[model samples]
Target chain A: MKLTLRVWRQKNADAPGAMAAYEVDGVSPDMSFLEMLDTLNEDLIVQGEDPVAFDHDCREGICGACSLVINGDAHGPERTTACQLHMRSFRDGDTIDVEPWRAAAFPVVRDLVVDRTALDRIIQSGGYVTAPTGSAPDAHAVAVPKPDADHAFVHAECIGCGACVAACPNGSASLFTAAKVNHLNVLPQGAPERESRVLDMVAQMDAEGFGGCTLAGECATACPKGIPLQAITTMNKEWLRAARTSKR
Target chain B: MSWTSCGWPPYGRRMALATRDRRPPTVRTLWDSSVGKKTVMAVTGLIMLGYLVAHMAGNLKIFFGADEFNGYAHWLRHLGAPVLHSHWALWIVRVGLVVSVVLHGVCAFQLSRRDIKARPVRYAHTKARTSYATRTMRWGGVILALFVVWHLLDLTTLTVNENAQAGHPYENVVATFSTWYGNVVYIVAMLALGLHIRHGFWSAAQTLGVGSAARARLLKGAANLLAAGLTIGFISVPVAVMTGVVN
Candidate 1:
């Protein structure tokens, strides 16, 4: 098989980049997307040319490190991470355009690597259990309702890929941040730090320069973990309540 | 200066609370942020709707004759509890209305900006999945904002093109509506306002957790009815005046 690639090339964060075209032959349909890229890189190395720089680890896709906006859709159109995307999804001789997630907060670290440390900052803002961090309470002590526990589990599956941010028109991470907020905020253990958790996470999200949510539901559609959009609704409700009741 | 120097000796011993920064998430998490804005949008939107209803009802009083209509206006200004002048009440209402409008607009603007920044590139398949009005709400909002300013200047402050002259307020309304250009402006603005209100009314309800199937149906019906009623009521004032039916 043959494929034409228009891949973004940048030397470093300060360098200007554009799509550079390449052609690879003898590609196999069975190769995963990254496997195909590996084949292309092998050829470039033999030819004494710089190999295309991309990010991927645990090509099985759970790491959330394989971030790419392929053919104009984040993580391609497979509803999964870029690492999980298979070459069979594309036709031979097709031209694939690859670019990094374009967001001010998630600056491009290299060709495809972005500094998602802001996401860590957002998480560190209060997405945690503050119950003295030392002793474990009995699991049965907290009596979490079945539905709430199920919802918390759903939000907890987020891999922090920033795909929601990339897919959003406002470059907003409400979906990602809300998932984290809702995950912890819903649990019995997270109750003690609820007010402070929401406040810190929200502040960190804004300080990182993300836009507010418009509730388009695209972030949910693009999510690899299938995080629900309702988490945002929950966050908004909590924020309003916090603002009104915290007059003291 | 020592913390205790001002008179409260324990001021220095007081600890600063480690308050968390709690701004709502950008529209990326629209569902989460939906609660606060939903409340604001719902409450404020309802207030604005109430104002519109009262305003139209007041305008309708013109059919009763100048003395009756003036008396109606005067009564609104004077007939409240404890004989509070309606103007004072009106001013208070106006302030509340303005606050609501600001909150609604601010929430929407923040959400829209986040949406724009989230996906800088236009989606290739957006047309198939999204409604035209939903997609264009941001631009429509800007138009409505501009329209609101012009509307206030024309009706409230009588500042239409700086040609506001002293005369009967109703006569000024009649003269303005009688002109072909004025009718055009009013009609255009009213149409946009109708579209803006159409989506907003029910959506605001939905945002504030009004998602029961029956409640959804009720809200939807009410929104359409309100939109249609307001459009026709406001438009009728201009139409009746222009056709010389009021005279």
Candidate 2:
């Protein structure tokens, strides 16, 4: 397959950027999206030009490291991570536009590489359980209801990919924060710090200059894991509940 | 692994408690949070939505006839009589609505500004991502706000109504709707109002955390129904006057 690419190129975070077009030939249909980029990069390196820089890890789509807004959709047209999206999804002669995630909270580091430490900051605020660390506990020691376990498992599917923020017109991180907050808030082990977890993480998100959610449902659509939008509603409920009842 | 063996997770519960110790949790009140501001927007939007329903119902009373409509108008002024002063109940309702409108508009404006600022760079390929009603919310809101001003001036103050009279609201309404520009502005504003409510109601439900997977469909349907009903109810008055059904 031969295709034209309108890839965004920037020298650094402080430098300006523009759409630099390139043509690639001899692309295999079985190659993943990143491998196609690898073909482009190999040609650029041979030509003594700076190749595009992006993030990718675990090429399996679970690490949440790969980030790209291809043709205006996060991770291209596929509902999976960029690394997991194959070249066959695109037709030959297609002109694909690739750019990094757009959000004040996630500033671009270089071409198609934006800093997502803001998400780490949010998790740091509160996204964990204070469980005792020792020998393995009995499986039946903690009895989690079936429904609650399902809720936790579903929310835990979030890969922290930042696709939600990239696709959101408002650049809101409500879904990501919601996923982290609800993943643990419903579990018996997570009960001790549940209230503080939501309150602090939400506050941290606000501090990161991310926009507020307007329920446009874009984030959930861009999500690779198919995390439901109702995750945000649950987070909002938890926040309100915490604000009302939390003592310290 | 080291973080675990060091006795506790460095970025977990201890961080939350340490921050709370340094500053009282109340120091960052609900108003300071994005979620909290949305609560304010949701509550105020609901208030305005309620008023629109009441206002549309009252507008329908014009179909009954001039005397009955005028009597209904008079009755509103003297509402809560023997205990409350004349126009007092009316004044109270008006003031509450004004507050609701102010808060709703302010929150919308602030949230929109932040939304724009959050994404300074635009995508190279511009694709329409959301629904028309969702995209036009900010502009539709502005149009509705300007229409509210014109509406109050034309009907309440008798400033823009043609050949105005103070006592007869039924006649004043007819005179206002009789003109072409009046019909044009009223109809356009009602359409904008419809679009606004179509998204606003459902959005408010999500912000307040009342909507869920089971009820999202219900809330969306209800929003559409309410938007259509209010727009038709209010626009019917002008249509009736123009068609000679109410004169």
Which candidate gets the maximum DockQ versus the true structure? Answer: 2
**DockQ, per-model, please?**
0.20, 0.61
lDDT of 1 by residue, B176-226 (tens): 786788888888777766766677776666455443444656876887888
Query: What's each prediction's clash count?
Result: 31, 0
lDDT of each: 0.72, 0.90
Report the lDDT tens digits of candidate 2 across residue range A20-53: 9999999999999999999999999999999999
lDDT of 2 by residue, B1-247 (tens): 3353554444442334323443345525567788887888899999989988988998899989999999999999999997999999999999999999898888788888888999899999879979988998999999999999999999999998877899989989999988999999999999999999999999989888898999989999999999999999999999999999999
For residue A65, model 2's alpha carbon misses the true position, in angstroms, by: 0.6
> What TM-scores does chain A show, candidate by candidate in order?
0.95, 0.98
Candidate 1 residue-wise lDDT, A113-154, digit = tens: 778877877776567775644587777877999989997999
- TM-score (0 to 1) for chain B of model 1: 0.78
Task: DockQ for candidate 2, please give it.
Answer: 0.61
> How much is B140 displaced in model 1, in angstroms?
2.9
Q: Which window of ten consecutive residues has the lowest lDDT sum in model 2 chain A?
A: A124-133
